[model samples]
Target: METCSIARIIRLQDLAMYRHKLCSLLFRLLPQLQGFPPGPPLKKLCKDEHVHVALTETKMVGTLPELPQDILMVIFAALEIPDLVRAGSVCSSWHSAYARLCNLGQYKQSQTPCLVYASESDPDNVLCLYSLAEKRSYKLTLPQPPIRSRYLIGSSHGWLVTVDERSEMYLLNPITCEQIALPSVTTIEHVKSIFDEYGDVCKYEISWHTGTRSSRKPPSIFALAELRGRLQWKAFVFPDTSTGSYIVVLIHNPQAQLSFAKAGDDKWTWLPPHYLYEDCIYKDDILYAVNIKGELHAFDLSGPVITMKTIITIPEHYDCDSRYIVQAPWGSLLLVFRIVHDHDLEPQPGASEYWNTSEIKICELDALWTKIKVINCLRDHVLFLGHNRSQCLSVNEFPALKENHSYFTDDNFLWTVGHTNNHRDMGILNLDDNNMEEILSPQLCSNCPAPMWITPDLRKMNLMGSMSQQP
Candidate 1:
């Protein structure tokens, strides 16, 4: 009996040492885990959960059902993107722990990007998210009016710019499922709602004119169903640094015009420039816009008056099908040119036509020299360019991403009409070889919104704090 007790004591001592070493390693790696407690990094055990490790000297011993949930979370949180996703799939207990961490607003600093699209199976309400790390598609349900019917023009800071059936706009946070209504589309200076005999909005008459060269052209009439998405080419949402409230910049039709609205504004304020702005981005409190002719402009909305400052001269040729602006990982600004097939250089965008992007050319803006330099290789960064806000992520941070590659989606609005089920034009492009290969399964490829990329996040917004001050 004495010998047996001695053996138990040794076993307990071994277990104690093992736990100590495990904790020591985790604490050392804690500094690397982002969003860790603010102060000195330390192992924080969940007080409610104790494994019941006894020294055996007291003649008491117990076993845990599994590793403590809190410890499992710490280890899972520190894992690389793919491993963390796999860890959650290991067992039910692990999944719960992972879910808790995700629910706790842990959109880790290096958030992994997910392919956001709508599926026909549950098209009206479900959003299909394809995770690159896990190579799996997950469905998330957003608040009412169904994501399928809405036009997702852009996604920024985890919120999507959705245009509803009434041609009204909103900012929707996919993870937290929060919605903020924007100014009505009819509020634009050129948009007029045409009411039917029953006093319901059935059509819209929007004025169209060419920049600087043409007189006012006859208005174009669009039915309510088509006008919902046809009104805007793209939209972007950003926070006004001065007020902490959000500002939404829109690239609308009537020739890709520029307009903006504050968080609580009753109407959108036009920027007065009609240069056919193709894409826009907000950085360092300045809004940078790129036009169809590759001209770059900057606007400071906080001032008493908004003036469009020309940063770069207009390009001589307009061969590039689409132009996108993204801030590089290293802080330099880049302009990406997406070109489709050679034969389809001037292909008209028809209601049912699909566009498959063929090649992508990147150019870095030499701000100091005021010239654009063509970059043959993206180096360690990958570009996600298409309908969603243009994004550039580093390859070092996301191991799943291939260097010098571009993952593109169908930014063409004509193919993504809510009423139809059409195959999307999305694929991964190898810059080195200019070869494109599809990665999505056949089913996911047939969805609405055309497979744009959005970085998955669970950050809760302080809607009250985001309310804009009276302009």
Candidate 2:
């Protein structure tokens, strides 16, 4: 019995010594592994036989002692540009992560979504970057004084475009501050009438897209203009009641059918309306629009007629009406609406209210439009103010949550007000783990009241001015 016991003790001691050596080798090679759980595969790889044999043999399966910055950069570079901006708030290390990640090819295919929030106090608008990846915030300066007395529309390929109260159209780069004034009418006649009568009465809408099969280098910008004039409509009778103002702009495809009724003209004319309804997203040629019922519709730009799909719906009970719907970085659509809920008006017992006056709802697109959450009471505007709302939107689809159902896992978006101050915030909500982090708040900028809007064209590396000048 004593002999058998001695043998067993010796065997156990040998196994303990082997495990200790294996663990030491693994820790030396991949220190980051300490943070993760030890699975069977790792255990097998770290076994006594595996460790010394692999180290002694001429062949090592994988690289060892990985460079932290280089791996961070790879993870950083893989992130969408906007994500780096959001990551800026995490810490100084992440801020450095932000700068190194801005390589040219990152945004070659599609631009990042950048918005310039200009305060009357400051001549230039504050160029705030909303990264689609990390889904956070950072600040940049505008190229020149944004078209004064006009609403800053957005940018395409680093070019910033805007329209004024007088309806004047101007395009510039916020980064380099180069401004270009486009002609009143590119080719359409209704636009000419609006410009002539109203002195640029039509408001300019900008949609930025990358080249299709024809061009692969830089992205293209599509300008959409809404013309409000008395005109004819085939869909409606004399003076179509269904139509208040006709949308007249250069089509994205330049081949889609466009019909317009000019001011004081008796008849409706046919033109291309490809870019009229929806904003052009660069990834695929899918065009997106929101119908009167407040449902998001998407169609192929190359197709003859758009077969619109209702990606999401705005519940009628949402209280206030919604104007725009923006697709968020994390595979979800953000629906912005103006709600009028009275504070003095007592709330119903056992009732759940989302927002105050203007409510912003984040809905996950994949699963049935589940209202992930909403932001109602934003800093000090009591009595439910339904002022102005627009969609500052972008989507990044990487480092996604393990489960597909979790939409908020890695999503980000932007919102710019018309009259209210340009207050911004970065929100991070992971439904999978139910983890939500919001840094840099809208309330922080309540003192800096500025009107800002988003530009679709967000490319990195190039100066904003040169990017605008590109073909």
Candidate 3:
């Protein structure tokens, strides 16, 4: 009974507060409706059966009967995006006040990294977002008949690079449920499509070349579903801020070849010097790629002819599943490595299908790449690594995030090789003290796809839509 009274009192307080806020907003409504700079006496206060406004010479008064916040939200939701934009301008304090009702609140979302994974119990069209701020999962439905099975090769900015069963690559905005189709794998330089008797594309023939175009390795035939796993490894996107144009860079298989294309391009342009690239990042109008052996190369793409330069190479000795190249919060390049040991988790003795991870060793390098500088602390920042584009975020901006720690997901190729629940390979590593902070239980993520970290971004969704409409 005591708790019920407290809850009732809190509800009454909220009702009064929201009522006061709405009454204040009424003063600005007329100015906004007139499309003027705003400063007008309401002129007259009149009461009507329905919500309306009028003016009298003696005294201008605007009146609004008190309504529940939920009822107000229902009314606000009836207004479209344009109306919401105007309504939001009435008061700066209303920017995030009851944010969900404010469609503009999406633009103000905290840039916290959320985990995108599947739910065992939900339909295939639905996915779950494990938000770090709330520490809870929410259901998000994708536009689909149903995604039988999909693979996410990369996440950048706020978009996810996803491949469907037909081996077609496309950009997906999980927040807005917008999808943009990319050039087909058939348009790639070395991949050709093969059609069946009914003229349906059945398989793709992929090849790699050496000195001359005539001299090349044997071509391999892969069905549509199997092609993405073999052909595409990771994808990165760079969107032009001014033009809203964007480019997607792909690090593919067969010695980690490189290919890129603009959003409206018809085909992929193959970049030269196919090194075994483990990770790549774009910063300061330059592209930096790192190989498995820890060699960094910079690409110049501004001129008519693209040029590449080898920056520096470090001799790596530790065993690791993957190496990532990321830009620091201070705008410097850093090479990070997570050393891990795998254990066979298969029920059968000889099966190598299921693998689990055990250890971690985070390493950094000097500017020259000749000296190994083991970073012990991240000070007010948190690092997110794995399938998502590697990033460093300030703890000051995200108070719930662990300071001086790296949150990673399962990027083990072994887990992707076949069907297995190895999502247990994800956890947070405390770089300050060099200890494993937490590893999620296998049961919590058993039904999902390989877990990936996607930084929540709503502003990019608008840019994505505009880019797709480009000529």
What are the models' TM-scores? 0.76, 0.38, 0.73
Predicted structure with the largest lDDT when compared to the true one = 1
The whole-model C-alpha lDDT of candidate 2 against the native structure comes to 0.34
Model 3: per-residue Cα lDDT over 45-75, one tens digit each: 1111111111011222232223345544543
Model 1 misplaced stretches (Cα beyond 4 Å): 1-107, 196-202, 209-215, 314-318, 342-354, 416-423, 464-471
lDDT of each residue in 1-471, candidate 1, tens digit only = 354345334434554445434433443433333333424212222111111111112211121124467756665655533334444543466667767776674526466677787666664777876778657666666788888877788877667888777778888877557788888888987789999899988888887764454545688898876786567867877767766767889888777788898766899998764567878888656799988777888888777787668888645343677888888878788888888773332446764444577788888888573987788998888998877778888888788888889998767656544424555667899999988888687574546555677764445455446432211
Q: How accurate locally is residue 466 in candidate 2, as Cα lDDT from 0 to 100? A: 25
Q: Return the TM-score for candidate 3, rounded to 2 decimals.
A: 0.73
lDDT of residue 145 for candidate 1: 80
Model 2's TM-score against the true structure: 0.38
- In candidate 2, what are the lDDT values of residues 188-307, reduced to their tens digit? 333333232547433432223222223233432223322211111101101111222111222222222233332223343433222223222222434455434655555543344545
The clash count of every prediction, one per candidate, is 0, 30, 6
lDDT, residue 408, candidate 1:
82
